[model samples]
Target: MTSTLASPDLRRRLEGIQLPDPLGFGTLMAPVMAIAHYRDGAWEDVRLDALDPLSLAPHTQALHYGQAIFEGMKAYRNLGTDLPGTALLFRPHEHARRFNRSATRLGMPELDEDVYVATLERLVSTLDALVPERQGQSLYLRPTMFGATAHLSVVPSTEYCFVVLATPSDAFFTAPISAWIERRFSRAGPGGTGNVKAAGNYAASFAAAAPLAKLGFQQLLWLDAVHHTHIEEFTAMNVFVRRGDTILTPPLSDTILAGITRDSLLRLAGSLGLSMVEKPVDVAELVDAIASGEDVEVFGCGTGAVVAPVELIGDETGLRLPLPPFPVATRLRRHMLDLQHGVLPAPAGWQRPVPTR
Candidate 1:
């Protein structure tokens, strides 16, 4: 409800926007946005403005050097009532920490967590009426920071800009997803930007993932860049394998995005008496186990999809992994959504409730 970068035109622009009947994932824009400029060695008054094109130099560092980082999170509405616009932010501080970590790795100034959290709360508060209340629906918030100065050389930009945009979306997974075990491409190198939600890392996925999409694959399971044998992660989600009472996931490395949903699942799995193993996952061993009649259940975890069971895993020479029902993933998935919507007990300080009049 509080903003320093208030513009009447921006508010008018947001008031004029309309959304589709079924707002698919990241498809419909919420008319309003929050933006703050960083220049002269400090961040200035952040503002709530209309979603519009930004004015940047032709040689902006983000456009050229790819110095951009972003985070995707959702805000829920109506915790105790069947009303719209309740706005519950899931584990927001962890995201704030990760955001600063990414900025430091990219050689940019770190963002203030207090400032970031406050800014998000303010934005969501003002835009509370736009938050969707339907099941499997919420306001998807995208917080992005980029170097904005005109720079040609390989150094960091002096100036930067951080913006948060929202989209009211339905469920990300309408059907069971089919993933191709990508042997040709690796999402990131050993010491690369894989852990961080950097824009370049996502752009790198397009060339390899596009081909798989052409072959009717919903997602690409990227392998290790060097060996092309170790399982890294799906292009966007963290993967987990279940063999009876044991839950196995690839340990956090420099090559995988540390998903918040993945972390929450691991935490809940511990309490549910599931043995957790975090190490390098060999893809060949995985297929071998699946073929050997191991009770294999494969699912992907992330904020967007929450928990999407993998229907099939295809590879060259016609290799497909058809997995059975994974109880752990199912239990975790239910627990996650339940807690997010106030069905189950809220974990220690997990949900940040929006103000209700």
Candidate 2:
């Protein structure tokens, strides 16, 4: 994949910037980014450029009306293979698929999925030196698109911009968390943008998250929007609970975001001789199961952390249930991470190796 604007200035900029120690999630950024503009319903001017701030008008459509979408992905350094410096992207097409799905839902233009993957490839290759080689660390990729037209109108903007930024970072969560059971505020409603990775969906969650953060809960286990009885998902990941010998998770509904890591682990479950079931998990039933001395565990999966075991579940009423330290979640996380880091062989098309310039 060639970038129309991959230049020597960009390479010099990359050389001058060094990766920082103790790389936090999305805190340290790569020196460069990739972008493409869409105008008159045509995508054009795709380029690899310096990671610079945008010069937008005050009436920019995205700034006012919130028509933006994004995707999270990563490129891992080969951890165990003979190729030491190899960069591998875990399920690029899957991320592209989800990105387009988000764009479709947000009334935005979708780029060619091939171009999307190629843009990522070029970006990672350009920042090959910055791809962290440590286990549980990777070059995080965030692909974002927004309405760029300077319009005060409420209708969708005619112009759009898609940008991809890279972050050299570690896993999103380092420790197991006590998830606050959110019954008061809903993350996504029935006919809302819950399923899409639009910017607004996360913005809406901050209201619920801020108070929960103060209460010392690191994460939130969101219940369904209407009844708040059925488990939907975590704020940023998909929820999986292991009950006895069977594993249960909420089925895919319009209210839940379909996570790529969640699907990958589900696909890997059968091969590991695990019984996985997809059904609506009720909060009350799960609380009862955990409180009754039954062997139950809750965990989450997403692109950032891959898998995080939920240490405790609770609500404001002082109803807290402790979960077993992740047994199934650990196994699944290790397997998937192995596949991602090239420690183990992944299925065909599951890994895409970026060519280093």
Candidate 3:
């Protein structure tokens, strides 16, 4: 990978761009992106360039074989932040580790963590102004890797491409969201790509999540693949439920994605005077606890969705599990956001500062 400085003309083009007021999630794209190609078993020519369409062969292996993975991250700018004018990226090294884990699972080449993180720093540093300064908005970064070879064979592609795109956006779920309990479809089974950020895992999830949009639900809650009795997670987030001062989430296994936000929350729960539990959560017990008026509050957390309270959990038959006021989630969300936007003093190496050249 190579580091090429942004020219003066490119900087002017980026500065001239304007972002709309709403700044919806994943809709608006930044003017620049970073890309690198993997060929002859080595990555080469990585550089920041214009975010333009790619000219690819018709038979790109990623198109047919689903050999692609991506990560969700964000960069925060200064306005409305405690450290004014200071830009920060939250735990980029953790994201890098997860990205490489996904790549290794797909039989793809693992990107060096240093190169992966430096690429993000270079991109955000060049386009720091594109990061939104709104309270719940920031520069959403997407780093994707795919098998770009045109061969149609079942073997792993010899060539791959890694690209990073940024978008200024708001929270994925702006308000409290309802989730549909998926019993008919399973996300993954034992020894599957459930832990990896494989593109196919999400596509397979659409069979259950897609229909929820029309049903007045915002997310789909997944259960274990073996018996469908244990709670796993959500479509794109990690699941957590609160009972009094205790927060519980399912334990990570080969069938669960170890979410970065989830880990941070578990680590921070003690500071919030909340106990943490990581065990196999049975669906029946969860439903019963909420129905018994135990003040059960459910929430989902991830990079894009961040901290979204699940207002209701229901199935197709119109059976809704009564939800309590999700105050715990709100407090936790604010705490994490404060740490991200510099309102609170973050833990050691929690937030990495960007060197704006």
Candidate 4:
């Protein structure tokens, strides 16, 4: 788990920089990064270096073949606790496993769990003092892997690079989001790479999200690719709907990403005496349920925002549905936040404390 430290000048730069006020999500990056490379059929030693632009070749495989993947995670500074300046990472192992899964799906070399977790720990420990202490603020960690070899033969690259970048930021969505239902564009097909967190999946979604952004919507709700009738997921988060004492979400399929926060809330729902069900959620039926006074509450969940209540759902045809107040979502959000900040008890192995050196 050994890691090389950053240069003296880089360390001084990191210490001297001031974090700006109103820290927006993923806006302010820390001055250091963790990097590793895979070559000759093995991963090289990880290094802690200055945060700078990467020196990839103009003809790199990642640029041409689109074999890039990434993971989003957070490290929190436990507030109002006996251990001041203590940092806690949430579900590092789960993220590492997902990262390996992504790499395997893209034909890239996998990163060892020890190396993945060690890189995160080293970076968080080094920047513990810089981690925001506010309740909704945290150090957002982005671990990415991509094909690095330069070739245009439509083959997977032999060389790859893994890098972890840190950003001290606030919540991604501050208010309830309004999503535009995209009926024309498809996010992923039946046999596509939607289940994996590949970089291209997101790039393919921007064409649908851009127009919605101008229409005062925050995200695009994607429907199934084959039939275009069933609800799939939002661009970045998993979809959830609450009716009465039951919670419903689309079941995991080859075209949906299994979100970590979505899984946590489903488990918490059962503990709170709420029934959870996973099935195909038809978009038309959901609209009808809301119209028929079924008291449906819609929300989105992901690692970035944790939980976001959906206030409105609309499409280009001018059909819109306004959901009621989100009591269940608010309760679940508070409970999850409390558990993350060490105010309440978290399940065993959910939170890992960073080493203080």
Candidates' RMSD to native = 2.4, 1.4, 1.4, 1.4
lDDT of 1 by residue, 1-357 (tens): 224644556555556456577888877777788998889898887888877899988999889999999988888765544333467888888888888888988988777887787777877776766677665677888999999999888899999999999888876775578888888767899898999999898888888876676677788888999989888888789998887777789999888888998898878776777787887888988999888878888888888888888878888768877777666666777778776765556678788776552
Please list the C-alpha lDDT of all candidates, in the order they appear.
0.80, 0.88, 0.88, 0.86
Better of 2 and 4 by lDDT: 2
Question: Per-residue alpha-carbon lDDT of model 3 for 1-357, expressed as tens digits?
Answer: 665666676677686678888999878898789889999989996788888899889899999999999999999875434558767899999999999999999999988888888888888988888888776789999999999999999989999999999999998988899989898899989999999899999999877777887887878889998899998999899999887777889999988999999999998887788898997788888888887888789999998878999888899767788597898899988888888887787778888888878
TM-score of each: 0.93, 0.97, 0.97, 0.97
* Model 4 spans with C-alpha error above 4 angstroms: 6-8, 80-84
Candidate 1 vs candidate 3: which has greater lDDT? 3
Q: Which stretches of candidate 3 lie over 4 Å from their true place?
A: 79-83
Clashes in model 2: which pairs?
A: none
User: On lDDT, who's better, 1 or 2?
Assistant: 2
Query: For candidate 4, lDDT tens digit of each residue in 259-356?
Result: 88988887777678878799888999988888787889888889888889999989988978888999988887777777777776678888788888
Error of 3 at 190 (Å): 1.1
Worst 10 residues of 1 by lDDT: 1-10
Clashing residue pairs in candidate 4 (N, C-alpha, C atoms within 3 angstroms): none
lDDT of 1: 0.80
